[model samples]
Target: MDDRLRERFAGLWSRTIGPTGAEAAWRALDAGYGAAGRHYHGWGHVADLLAGHDAVRALPDFAGLDHDALALAIVFHDAVYDTGRADNEARSADLLAAHAGDAAAEAVRAAMAMIRATAAHEPGADPATRLMLDLDLAVLGAQPPVYAAYAAAIRREYGAVPEAAWRLGRAGVLGRFLARPRLYGTAHFRDRLETAARANLAAEAATLRGGPEP
Candidate 1:
């Protein structure tokens, strides 16, 4: 899977910034996602996002989506992740913008916006943006065991946080998503994963609060 992702991303990067830059960009991406202390926001998470992106490319709604820009967004969205930092998304976007070089100005801007929007998981007017956000959040709708593993990985990422604080913070984040009218912005994701995502969030929230096993 890692090798496949490398080939896919290398191809996209070559198209975006030329072959000369693809090697360095791939090295940076691999190092960033493979960095120490990353339990959840790692290469595996990026791979999942890319898989979700590929899964929906055939949908009519995504026909107009900027495939290259969306791919860039997925690859760089969490490239600067840090549990102790609040500006990872901003930094990640900046990192992409720096490496974008002479890539199409519009595509670079669009990718940066999509990367930043992941901070709040909010969709903008663009269909690509909506799809990007949805793909980044696809894990929310994973099967119960998958979702449980994701939750555990996140907890491990924040291992420095006190248990009480981590539980409260994690539950609060889940509650905010649950409070939204819809967790998924794309109709495709909503139709397929909304119910499952909601159940997963609620279950995780309950467990966080020490209410019951789910």
Candidate 2:
């Protein structure tokens, strides 16, 4: 959220997504999703991911390209998120095409592909995709209070599910995350956040099991 980052994000919006349409998309995101929904994967999430991306600048042979496209992808990645539906990516892609036009449509498609690749939990995927996925789930390693708030917000987003169902489903999701060789594929994140993320996941799993809180 620094001025330089904000300016970069703005530039991405203006050049890639169009200022007018981007503004409209922002309005739609804010109004349609409400504040809590926004917190789940909104501007804050995009900013966090961008910050994480910036953190990996020391990687060798990291020739940055099409950052505007990546930025657009981050912005729209969860644009149509719905807990009840399994095709959020498709819906998000559709919305991006409708709102941002052809170039953004392609970017959205590529971004969705990258997002879906994370579902495999493989360690050997494209480095950028791995980094992006890690950033998306970076909250797993956040301070307890922050992670707790995010956990509550995510639960609220899926309020229709019963507590038992939510607990089981969420534990399954977190288990998959913990099963990965590294919580974050980037060397920086692997070194700095991996242990914390595993600890957090274990604590969350305990809570899901109705054990004592951490």
Candidate 3:
């Protein structure tokens, strides 16, 4: 990891888990991102989410948010990612509960809740949840070349799956995103990300469906 990201985690860990535990957590998260077969969910993904969070944080609605807690959540949201498992968020949340300070319980709780909501991403009433989910989904709005690379990286992570099954499953996911009335949860994101996301998803879904991407 770069020094800035390393130092960001360093500050978070030192404040929440102290120097020793912070060191350990830092090593674990850094190593986790660098682990084998994590093309899509690694450091690049975290960096994107961090950038999205920064963009959203500037918005009037989220200006008063507890950024520290959300930052913790963003870094660790996919900390235990396993493409085949449904428990990654829960496991990641468990890791946070074990390491974070008692003073952070409320934020941790909110973060964990937001992380879990990524599973279905159904409509939500909580403002924090909306922003968190939207930030994570911002990758959908990336320019075509970037989105294509993102798709390829994900396919790499699921390399074990047979091509036919991967096609069906991946198509289902893209179809669902297309089905959503609005891919973004926040108005800010809807304004900024929705159009590109729609184009990307439609193009991907076409490719997955045996048609040429638009």
What's the C-alpha lDDT at position 206 in model 1? Answer: 84
> How high is the lDDT of residue 75 in model 1?
93
Candidate 2 lDDT, tens digit per residue, 135-170?
677788899888888888788878889887889999
In model 2, what lDDT does residue 90 have? 69
Candidate 2, TM-score vs. the true structure?
A: 0.79
Error at 7, model 3, angstroms? 0.7
Candidate 2's C-alpha lDDT?
0.68
* Index of the highest-lDDT prediction: 1
Question: Could you give candidate 3's per-residue lDDT for residues 1-214 as a string of tens digits?
Answer: 6788888888876665556567667777877787988899998888888877876687698877777767788888888888889888888777777766574567778777877777787759988778878888888998999999999999999999988888899999998888878888789889988999999999988888894335
CA displacement after TM-score superposition, residue 80 of candidate 1 (Å): 0.2
The model with the greater lDDT, 2 or 3, is 3
* Candidate 3 Cα lDDT to native: 0.81
Give stretches of model 3 more than 4 Å off. Answer: 16-20, 101-103, 211-214
- Please report, as a residue range, the 10-residue window in candidate 3 with the lowest summed lDDT: 13-22
Q: What's the TM-score of each model vs. the native?
A: 0.94, 0.79, 0.92
- Model 1 C-alpha lDDT versus the unseen true structure: 0.86
Per-candidate clashes, comma-separated: 0, 0, 0
- Give a tens-digit lDDT track for model 1, residues 1-214: 3688888888888776666677777787778899887888989888888888888898788897789889998999999988888999999988888887767678888899998898888776888889988887888999999999999999998999988888889999999999999988889999999999999999998888884345
After superposition on all CA atoms, what RMSD does each candidate show versus the true structure? 1.9, 3.6, 2.3
Highest TM-score, which number?
1
